[model samples]
Target: MRSKQEYMEKAEELIYKTYNRFPVVFDHGDGVFLYDTDGKEYLDFAAGIAVMGLGYHDKEFDDALKSQVEKLLHTSNLFYNVPAVEAGELILKASDMDKVFFTNSGTEAIEGALKIARRYAYNKDKSHDHEIIAMNHSFHGRSLGALSVTGNDHYQEPFKPLIPGIRFAEYNDLDSVKALMNDRTCAVIMETIQGEGGIYPATEEFLKGVRKLCDEHDALLILDEIQCGMGRTGTMFAWQKYGVKPDVMTAAKALGNGVPIGAFLAHGKAATAMSPGDHGTTYGGNPFVTAAAAKVLELFEKRKIVDHVKEVGDYLWEQTEALSQKYKIITAHRGLGLIQGLELSVPAAPLVKDALLNERLVIISAGANVIRFVPPLIISREHVDAMLIKLETVLKKHS
Candidate 1:
């Protein structure tokens, strides 16, 4: 194996400079611990940006993937595949939605949802509905369709002239959304818990209000659960906590527990938009990815993963609040389940760096000043205690 520095330099020369990567090169991992080529170990709290729900090298998950790979991989969507059907059914049963369309990533799922929403309107009166209302400070995905619905001007500025008929509303503010929605609106897409927007969760009242607005206007309610769903929010889905239902829901991230898979689900009228040959993909809904997702869902059922997330998530929230009160450097703390953010008095980048380098604890920074903590759903109480110790030490040093 090559040295970490040499490998990184080589990667820099070959790959695009899209990501400013950390200096560590992980060789392998198990549970919450990752070992680098230099024999250095780090406790991972970020969990690969909330993708690894069961943690690294989970035995049952690995076995399921390997078994499915050996049996079947891909056979194109021209023919039906068992894994696809199984995964889709599992997701439908898990969610309130009735049907599902698989995709390769979260952005693709968002794109599919957008298409369904638009097409549903087009099929309706054929003249009145086309616009989609998204929230300010929302992060859906990076694809053009998802980008168009995303609220940030900074991300949208470079990719000028995106999909038309998209409007912005203030997140968690019912009045802002009410002002923008009209007869032309086909959908209102938002995250139940905004992940990339600094872990902001929609208030229960706001979600219920939006649900009513969409119902009244006959617009599809599309919830983007890419980062906050699949047991990350203690429930199997975040919308369950909000006490409102969406006509269409997009999910990815932890659906396959690190394997690339995404899905868009719809209920009732929204499901009728797509007929055969209307939309399809070569790699989407392939056996390999769907197999992984099937196993993930299976584990979710067999292991009671949601309960684990609930216990650990509550512990994390309590500890974060305690830290906020003790340090006074932390301006605020907010979130549900494992999706948490600590708003610091100063920039959190230095603290994140210190956590990695000095404390050997891995964390991520959301926005500029908020430190994000999205550990694996299966993370133990012991792991949380360990992380709390390191976090306290790091915050004290920074203060």
Candidate 2:
């Protein structure tokens, strides 16, 4: 009963088979490392799918949560709570957006953003036939609403008859977007940096062009930053790098630094479109989660996390580039700041397995061949160096 295998077997019997999860049964985490039930330490590069930006067991973050738990937890959105208001204010300030709606998860945030676009159009034109243009090879979320706009055929095929008006366009290709977009297009949704589709970053020119197109068509530009936001891209949000502001931006993952919070921030027409009946959430802006989010945001500012990302991200990119040079199996390295990926000539799954079981290093795979590196933002140069050595051992075996 104490063994990892026993726990995993029990989980397999009880849990749904939706995920092909790894065999590692993690019991706890501290700083940038996770310890399995067997107490095998792993240098964490995945960071709980980019959720643990500040790393595990951060004293300040944990203490804030502890305090909030004692003071208040759920007052619900039925009435006002201090943390919700404070978190909303901080999110709006960070994003420079006029309004925000909190959600329980990133999927909900995407759902909210899509509704904002649709409702905004409806308010102006009284039209139900509005189309949403999303990028090809992009990942949004698993909800029906989020899935409707997710542009991958594999993920969308089983769930057909999705929201009727979502169109797919090529990422970083303005012409492809131009070809699909028209007057009825109410929103152009995209990941600020495509994560699961092999870690591609949007080129400055393409993002700027999309902004122009949205402006011309009077369509809201919804940037899904669930994976790329929260200082992963050397800015509070990835679009800030190019000075292109989205009408509506969806955020999650690192937003609460592991406390499960998501938000959609909007400005101008999109902000005004949502009335009380248009959207609502019972547990979305509860005192507990919003307190975690507010504290996370406050810590981000105090720690100068954005500036730290810039410095370390440069170092990470350099080290990855060096590894690419050394290992001919690597075809390309793509991404910005901390969210880097290495596309290998061979399948990445085996190497990832080897990294975990043999090297005791945690990394993730994306789009079949890309090895994703989204370590905790709190990781130092020494942590990256450690990850490199362990990863190199696996790479050497695989290559």
Candidate 3:
């Protein structure tokens, strides 16, 4: 087997320099832990950026994927497939949405939702351009259309002349959203809990007010649940906790556990926006991917994953709050369920690196100073306690 250094050198030579990767090369994962090439074990708190909800090396997830591989893989959109159909049904039932359009990734899901909102407005009247209201410090995706809606200037500036007709509003600020709405506004999109920007969950009052504004302005409410949905926040969808339903919602990441799959769901009038050939994907919702997604949904119910998350998440937060009190570098901590963050007085990149190299704990940073903890839904309190010990050790060394 190749050494980690050799693999890292090859990756730097062949792959795009898109990510500032860690030094370790992961070999495999089981439950909430990952093993490196040298067989060093590290507890995984990032969960592949909140995608591996079922954790790693689960028998059920593995069996479902292998079963689909033996039966069929791709049939294209021209033919009907049982796995895709079942997955769609599950999504609809879970979201209470009328229609579902599957995509290959979260960004594509956002793109599809944006298209549906625009087409719905065009179906009404195409006299003028329709605008979408997105939130400041929000992250939708990297695609052109999704990037246009993302409110971060750091991600948007380099990709100039992106899709126009998109406006930005302050997150959790209902008045900012209301001010952006007008006759030309077709949709208002945001993450129920802002992920990459920081672990900031929207207030119930703010979401309810935004929903009312969307209704009054004839704009569809779109929730980007790519990072926070699928039981990451102790709910099937984060919006459900606020008692607000978006006209459209995008989901991915944990939707398929580790398989590549995404979906955009629409309700009521937004459901009928796209007709026959308005939009489509060649490999979206293929049997292989949808089978994994279907199995994930089933496992979520059978394991009572949402309830598990609520329990472990509460314990994790309480520990984190205590850590904040102990460590002077920790300024604040915030989040819901497994999606939580610890804001530091200093830049968090160094701390994240230290955690991996010194403490053998895997985690990621949100924005500049927040250490985001998005562990798998199946993590127990024991895992949380282990992580806290390692984290505290690292913080003390730094202090």
**TM-score of every model?**
0.98, 0.99, 0.99
The TM-score between candidate 2 and the true structure equals 0.99
Stretches of model 3 off by over 4 angstroms after superposition: none
127 Cα displacement, candidate 1 (Å): 2.9
C-alpha lDDT (0 to 100) for residue 249 of candidate 1: 96
| Candidate 3: tens digits of C-alpha lDDT, residues 61-134 | 99999989999999999999999999999889989999998899999999999999999899998755889999
Q: What is the C-alpha lDDT of each candidate?
A: 0.91, 0.93, 0.93
In model 2, which regions exceed 4 Å deviation? none
Question: How accurate locally is residue 323 in candidate 1, as Cα lDDT from 0 to 100?
Answer: 85
Displacement of residue 267 (Cα, Å) in model 2 is 1.0
lDDT of 1 by residue, 1-399 (tens): 788899999989999998898888888888998888899889999989999998999999999889988999999899999999999888999997888999999999999999999889988887743799999889888888899988898889999899988999999999999999888999999999988888899999999999999999999999999999999998999999877989999999899889999999999999888888778999999999999999999999899999989998999888778889998889989899999999988998999999998899999998889999998888988999999999889998999
Model 1 misses residue 82 by how many Å?
A: 1.2
As a whole number from 0 to 100, the lDDT of residue 357 in candidate 1 is 86
How many residue-pair clashes does candidate 3 contain?
A: 0
Model 1 spans > 4 angstroms off: none
Residues 315-362, candidate 2: write the lDDT tens digits. 999998999999999999998999999999999999999999999999
